[model samples]
Target: MVRFGVIGTNWITESFIAAGRKVKDFELTAVYSRKLEKAEEFASKHKAVHTFTDIEQMAKSKEIDAAYIASPNALHAEQAKILMQHGVHVLCEKPLASNVAEVKDLIETAKQHDVLLMEAMKSTFLPNFQEVKKHLGKIGTVRRYVAQLCQYSSRYDAYRQGTILNAFNPELSNGATMDIGIYCLYPLAALFGKPKEIKASGTLLESGVDGQATITLTYEEMEAVVYYSKITSSTLPSEIQGEDATIMIDHIGHFEDVKIQYHDSTEKIISGPQDNDHRMFYEIEEFVNLIQSGKRESSINTHELALTVAEIMEKARIQFGLIYPADRLQ
Candidate 1:
């Protein structure tokens, strides 16, 4: 079994631990937190064999073969560099890095050390997303793709009350686009490739962060409009419209089910799985396989998409003036 160590004790870590239980090849060996008390509490709660406050020590420890990084966006690149240098493979959370330079550095560091470095893009690994891609052509010559993911942050209320939370803080590199819109950009890049031209604009809060944004990406024969927000939730289902038919996705990023409808209303296709253990199990499975097989790159989903998504987000950040300190590398 491949032993795993997680770098944070947030919501995503709980999902990773619960999902790791279902994967026979993975073992939850260790967990880390900035505080020793919090680390001990998390270790006991998850039944992790070891816990630590020093990530450097944990990375060099013999207990784990791989590290699952669920830290904030700004910390992802630096933490990944440290882990890779310590000869530990890393499976980092989405957005991978705050900008392209950081992504490049991480990728190069992994390559130089001969260790695996993968972006934990949970949605891409799902069978539902694969099914959606498989039957995308059934939607005819795809002309336009529109996806929206918006959920009002519970922390926003606290931020409004003069409490600064990570979600509203640009220093943490947490915003609607990075938190949610990365979901929209991933599938777009996976399915449509990089756009020929990109235009993005968003409403910025007084805190100098984007609460909601709309991005329009133009390609050869198609264009995609992606909307993301942390200030409000969305009711409209994401859809791809084409000349022949349309495919409606239940959720853009965590698409669990897909329904295909023909233009004539006579042809229809519905496909997906019913198992929903937080839609994070697929990523766990992939990481385990990569660690066990000594693979340096992803065989299921390439890093090309990750690089492209970073590029798009970087451009969007420049356009919207949502600069994180991490963007200094840009």
Candidate 2:
């Protein structure tokens, strides 16, 4: 079994643990939190063998072969670095880091440590997404790509009541672009390479982060647009248009349903029915296989792809005049 430890005791972390349980070789070995009580409670609930109040302690303990990082956006790189330095493989949740520089450094650190490092982007690892990639040629010459996700935050109500939550706080590097937009951006980068030019516009909240943003990326013969928001909801499905047909994706983040519509008015479903709840299993399985195979990076969610997404986000932040505290860090 690939023994695992987890950092962060949040809903996302819980979901990851639940999915990891479905992987045959996965084992939750430890749980880490800043408070001992929280660590103990989480470890007990997850049946973890160990609990850690200090991250470095967990990293150095040799109790786990890998760690899943679900901490706040600002802490992803640092926590991942710590684990990697101690010869622990890291499956870090996306955007990977606050900026391109940190993403570069994290990749380098993993290389230096000769450990596996993967951005836990569950969407791309899903079978539906893989099917979408497989059927891209059915759409002929791609002319346009439009992807979007906009969900009203559960924490938005508190923010409106004059209470600043971490989701809207720039100090934690949280924002619509980083939290939600990456769902759209990462897939685009995966399907196509880096764009030739980018144009970004967004609404900045009073707390100095994007509430909603629309970015248009210009390629050689095609252009792509991505819209994301945390202050509202959108029912629109993302589309990849080409000369022969268009591929429609139900949810860019999860990629539940995918369809192809041809110019002749013919339609075809490209993806099979999937269990959305256990979708994270694919990524966990991939991470384990990478570790077992002695690979340092994911072939699908590659370091270059993560770096491209980071550079795109950095440019978008510049366009919005939004700067997180992490952006100022060395």
What is candidate 1's lDDT per residue for 138-159, written digit by digit as tens? 7778999999998889999997
Which residue pairs in candidate 1 collide?
none
Expressed as tens digits, the lDDT of each residue in 212-265 for candidate 2 is: 999999998799999999999989999999999999999998888899998888
Misplaced by over 4 Å in model 1 are none
Per-candidate RMSD, Å: 1.3, 0.8
Best by TM-score: 2
The TM-score values for the models, in the order shown, are 0.97, 0.99
Give me the runs in candidate 2 sitting further than 4 Å from their true place: none
Taking all chains together, the TM-score of candidate 1 against the true structure is 0.97
Q: What RMSD does model 1 have?
A: 1.3
